[model samples]
Target: MTAGERTGEKKDQCQGTGDINFKDRIASSPCVFTIGVAGDSGSGKTTFTQSIRDIFGEDLVTTITLDDYHLYDREERKVRQITPLHPEANRLDQLEHDLVELKEGHTIEKPVYNHATGRFDPPIRFSPGKILILEGLHTLFTPTLREHLDFTLFVEPDPEVKIEWKIRRDINKRGYTREQVMAELGPREEDYQRFIAPQQQYADVVVRVRFSKYGRERGTQDKVYQVSLSQNKITQSIEDVDLSIDLFSLLSLSDRNFLIEFSHEQRNTERSGELIFDGELSARMVERLEQSIEDQTQVRPISVFHNRGHVTATEVVQLILAWRIIHQRVFLERCHHLDQIQG
Candidate 1:
């Protein structure tokens, strides 16, 4: 039984970390929305979810990286001749326990993985937020860990794109030479295929990103993307959310060079729908779509696509994916309400 059932009092929705009254109420109960994001490193997982963070703000969203659960430090892994992508290299069992504790609204001293130093730093206390994001290579690798995720996202970038992104990041930020980064790819990709790629089949939403022809012609391929969003059909309808695209408005943007396609198919034996977007869309074009979603669902402005002269396909997909997550949140909320009434 839930704390709410035992107390027999309806739990108020948490406003954020700053709301004292809500915090007090939550202290007596556990209410959290957990989202698991899985992807190979440098696959744009963080870039893709920027809109969700914009909507909920950091105060209400707590993100935990699975890298911290690494069983071996960088040098140790080198000695062991194993990549971080290997399943045996992480503390998966402890990750599961920590997730469960966070779900119950308990604080945990989460370990820190220093990316720059390639070592485990001192652990820090982590408190649950209204929304919890568990992002890493193995979030969906184990069934028990998957069970605690309210929503799952998988990012699959084109192989070339992944390599380019990783090389840039590791070289510029992680202090790796281009040659060293190139050498690591052979073994890393092998490990990624064996241990990480399979998690894509389990995600409710899979985002595939590739270079856009428009960007290639303009020599801005790094700044632009062609993103395809495959959404597993909604599990069940929720009254509070609706997924609708305004075709009329979408078609009216004649000045923008863009492409949008919708199709239905079976992915991994599950029915799913895919929307592909390519080209340089004007900010107004994206706003019209966002407004359409808000008008239909009466949801507040989601604003993942920042107002600019042109919007990239990545930003457009982020808006749509964020909308789906909003729907998931509402559905989970409704289920919680039903449990309260039954109790």
Candidate 2:
């Protein structure tokens, strides 16, 4: 199967319903739940965000790409001999300001970064939705920006996988030659290590993708992915839904060879729980678990995802992340209420 097949294609379906108390609370108050997704270019950050989008329909979710904050266009970066991965190449200050504005349910004129031309387009008046997702290189890089985000995620793909994804994307989507893509890697990696990698420490969750060891032993390494989601221990206190996987049920019903590993570990000097999943997964099992999630959260299934009828390790990660986001929304609401009472 192709990569698209693994992740599943989008299906046209109606939205799902959930406990409307939180939704109504937000609608009345007009607060935005901000999420920050940080990753190197082509690290599958877009794909990761799409999973969250699937959980909440388009009407409630809005996305902003951080590339729009680039301080210099492609030619300018080349002239300056600076990589876009460097903090100086991006207007992080403007990003912090925009994030604050969005969090306060205010509209802002946002810039647009055109990948095809490696330049920016005219600014557009952008409005904040109920849930605003800010994704880019330095999203979680600074303390000020992190303060604005309700939840933060970082995506780190293995070096080889990142190179493969980047080369394919820059050449196919961004109008770059093979030689140009290869030549830029040296400086980009240097800047990435210095500026981007350290931001992982601030993330509430970190996703690392690499070649599947099981697939490697079976000589299918290129096609299978091993994805590890490392979640910060601090976020555990607010978990409102049960996320335990029924391993017994999964093992009995699934025919595919797979590996699942769970561990408590320290990532960047922070306590975190990491779960790794690889190989083909059981679709029915995942769907059942999703239903359980909705049941506990007291939300009706969003028809878009409920009707998709396909499952992979990717979808599982998305479901968990979506659940976290929903509860984070609730948690924020409670905090707001508490502050009002105290005041």
Candidate 3:
């Protein structure tokens, strides 16, 4: 019997008091929504989660990197000559245990993997919250891990775009030479296709940041693309924002548009909110929202576009809160439906 049924509270039980109700009981517990971002090494998975963290705020959400679950450090793996992309490179069983603890709303001491030092750092204890954003190379690869997630996201950029990002990120952040990065890329390509790419089929959403021909083509400019699969198979192109200054420049804008549309379509059928901001009230609200977001996220909202573009850190937090509200309503609706059926 599940925990709810074992509590012996008929009203609290999700399933009716019957012999065949055990399955229903397991299905109706308070759900933890998990979003997994899986992609190539430099396909912006970490960057994507940072944006999500900013929007959700640390109070309501927690993020865990799958890198922390690595079984061996870089030096050890190199000594063994085992590629990090392989399944054996990680402690999959421990990861499964961590997920179970999170599902139960219990705290866990998460291991810290330091890429620069090539080892595991001190264990950081954290309690799972309403939303959990997990990102890394093999986040979606394991079937057991995949089943626990409420939503799965795949970040796939064009190969050329990813290579450029990998080079820049490795050189600047990981202290890898351009030649070393290039050499590792070829060896990892097969592993990525074998293990990572296959997970995309199970994804509820696939986010692609692609370069499109628009105004003056200075270089490769990325436009955010979001595909939602829960309510409807809708594909949207988020407005093109400049990616020169920072990687997260366009993430909030894309997330805002997606959440607004998704919530409107699911909850209120009224199309009252404007998709694009233009007028004075909208502009003022944007300014106030930006200020609020900055107060929460501790990051300055950099200007990332031309033509009267203004997005603040506070607005991003508001967008995430709005998404949480919508998600909670959906959860409650499901609970009500289950209660009625049990009755």
Candidate 4:
């Protein structure tokens, strides 16, 4: 299917009453829940955020596309020999300013970047609400910007895999030719390494989607691999393998069964293990890692999310469970022993 068609299908599947409960929870939270999903183009950032919007409804959730903060138009960027993926290519200061405003509970006019024409579109006015999902290439890169968010996420699929997805997406949805995509990809790669990849260090969650082993063994190229990273002292390799296994195993189940189980259990569950069988290990490891890192650095770690767009309501519940596990673990780890003792 074409990219737009694929997106539409996912959207259709995502519509249900289950999201109402999720939205109600966000509504009751004291502070707005801000999530940033950063990754290369076509890494499913937009799709993921859209699913969240579908859950919360556009009225309760406002999404700010970091692509809108580009410092130059595509043609201008090319003329200046500037790689669009480079940090210099974006208006980092403006993004920081806007995020700060949002954190302070104010609304701001946001910029719009048009991929079709490769330029900034008209500025759009947005009001801050219960949850804001900020997404794009460099959403989590800057320290100032990262500080304003409640959750920071990085989505890095394998290079070859992402590129192929990009080719298919742009050609089918955006009406680009193969040669056009190839031209864009060449310069973008340099920018990605220098500007984009470094942001992964700041992510509370890193999701790496790889092709399934069965698919690989059968020479199928359509498999996806996802790995999540948090500020825990644990190494990336360990987290990647564990998160990948947990997510992939979850994805393997039929969506119908996943939803039925999630809806029946979410409201009553608190412990991480109650939500998913294998999530407990991932949660404990993350807690230990966060404790080690904070003890050494004296700075609290950020929370990140790997948003896979629209699965069954059960899948959404599982995703939220994983997030809460990571968030609670890190939060507890950051507190001083004195505070715990006093409590």
Candidate 5:
């Protein structure tokens, strides 16, 4: 299995999960829905999770960043000469146990990795919620933990873009210098190849962020993070179809898979551009979805998410994740129904 590839096996096909009947599991504990998200450093893991935290509202969703499960604090990692990417550097078994417990609607005192102090802060309480986003580098990498996740997401960005994000974030936010950022990246590279990238094969949804190569690519320094999406064939609704209509005009790809361009880049000479979700999409769509979510969930979002009246990749991806989590019963039923029809 590799990045951008689905495991190609159904949950029923996997061993040790007990049974393939998610409905029974849902019935047993309907309150908790967990999504396991994995991506390399600076690949928009936190940004995407933040978007979800906002859309679902903090009260309804809980995010457990697996970085908190690091076996060694930052200083310890440095002293041991180990990067955070290695399996040896993390408490994988404990992470798996915590996720299993969360799925069963249990609370946990999850560790807090303090980047500023290079140590573990006092653990924070994680009460179970309707939705849980487990976001980090090795999130979907562990098989046992993967089983407990209802949705699995993987994000991989263009190499240059990823490096730029990592460098900027480490220096500005995580208290590191440019030289230190560069130094640690080399050490982490091997672990990334072995642990991080391989998890993508298990991802139910894969989002690739890159410079628009075949189509529009222009973006300012801050907002250039365009996204490409692929997924296991999903059970989409009328709302999903309408959402697709909203993403691209003169679209090249299906609604389920499209590229979001951050700037106003026009189509090429071929007239057959790659599926582009340029920033110039309609505003009504966001409003429509916002209203739909409010209607369904009985809680309106704080405000419609947009940048200068243009819809963003970050915002739309948040909607897609919301669609998956909020109507998970619909998604799961439709999938099984489709399977029965096909079988």
Candidate 6:
């Protein structure tokens, strides 16, 4: 039962994130949206989602990583001469089914893929929350999956930077040796070319993370995050964006060169909106941007961890997503109120 149902609270319309069956409260819970973030491995998907959990609170959002759908264990994939990136390697149909059920206000026992043991563990059962986040490489690869998302964010870290990040993460965090990391990258690139990067064409937002060459031409790798907003899907106009700097640039990707948009409204002393930053960044800037006015109704600062001197590219991307998620929520909530009053 929903939290409101158990406590007998008069649950009126809300931006969701409450314990309520979404289907039963569809009219009051139009903001119960699903977000899909897709990219190749080590593109900071886990880090980004972790930051959201910190900000929105652990119980507000339900996150599902598509990687756990691997049909074969590591040894099984090796024996079959197949990599996990291939569509055949994953149980996507099941993933779609569970997401559909979750969308309709049902619980699901999601599968768990254990990387260290190269095997499948028991499934973890859970109910859906106000927001559902579905992330993986092939999330947009399939039409069925794409149709289910309210917002799609494609993470594009620079090739060189991604490799560096992958090596560090796999070896240091995942217990993989240097040699294993290299071997994995080659097959991953092949898989990406075949199945991953192509999905970016359908994304509503493409988060491009690159080690900025503008940073003093030094040996250091301070990064810049260019969050390109696709004007086609989002309802917000460029005129409405309140970013300060007029620094504008255009770039092409996915067979369409999307115009980069920028603006920032003052949100807690920091510029909040689709804006650009190319130099050193502070963790506090990220926190302030997240708890912006657009979504401050449900806003709370995410606990931040950074290096002594600067914030990492991964951290910045998380804040970018948090910005998008919160803004989308606020927009929907207001729109729904207007619709109800008219009705």
Q: What TM-score does each of the candidates earn?
A: 0.85, 0.85, 0.62, 0.62, 0.74, 0.71
lDDT of each: 0.76, 0.74, 0.54, 0.55, 0.64, 0.61
TM match of model 5 to true structure: 0.74
Top-lDDT structure, candidate number? 1
lDDT of 6 by residue, 74-109 (tens): 889889888888989999899889878887778889
Question: How close to the true structure is residue 154 of candidate 6, measured as C-alpha lDDT?
Answer: 77
Off by over 4 Å in 4: 1-25, 28-30, 47-51, 216-322, 325-343
| Tens digits of lDDT, candidate 4, 1-343 | 1111222333322222211233344465445657778899888676544534543467677777787899999789879988768888889899999888886678788888898888778897877887777888888777787777766667777787688779989998877899989988877888888889878766654555444332432212322232222232221110211222245545565332211111122111221112222111233223333343333223334222234332322233334424433332233222222245657
Highest TM-score: which candidate? 2
For candidate 1, lDDT tens digit of each residue in 76-99?
Answer: 999999999999999999999999
| Winner on TM-score (1 vs 4) | 1
Instruction: Give the Å error, residue 132, model 6.
Output: 1.6
Task: Give residue 82's error in model 1 in angstroms.
Answer: 0.2
Per-residue error (Å), model 1, residue 122 = 1.0
Backbone N/Cα/C clashes per model: 0, 4, 6, 16, 1, 4
Candidate 3's C-alpha lDDT?
0.54
Instruction: List candidate 3 segments past 4 Å from native.
Output: 1-31, 47-52, 215-343
Alpha-carbon error at 259 in model 3, in Å?
A: 20
Candidate 5: pairs in clash: 259-277
TM-score of 2: 0.85
Model 3: per-residue lDDT, tens digit, 235-258? 221111111222254444433322
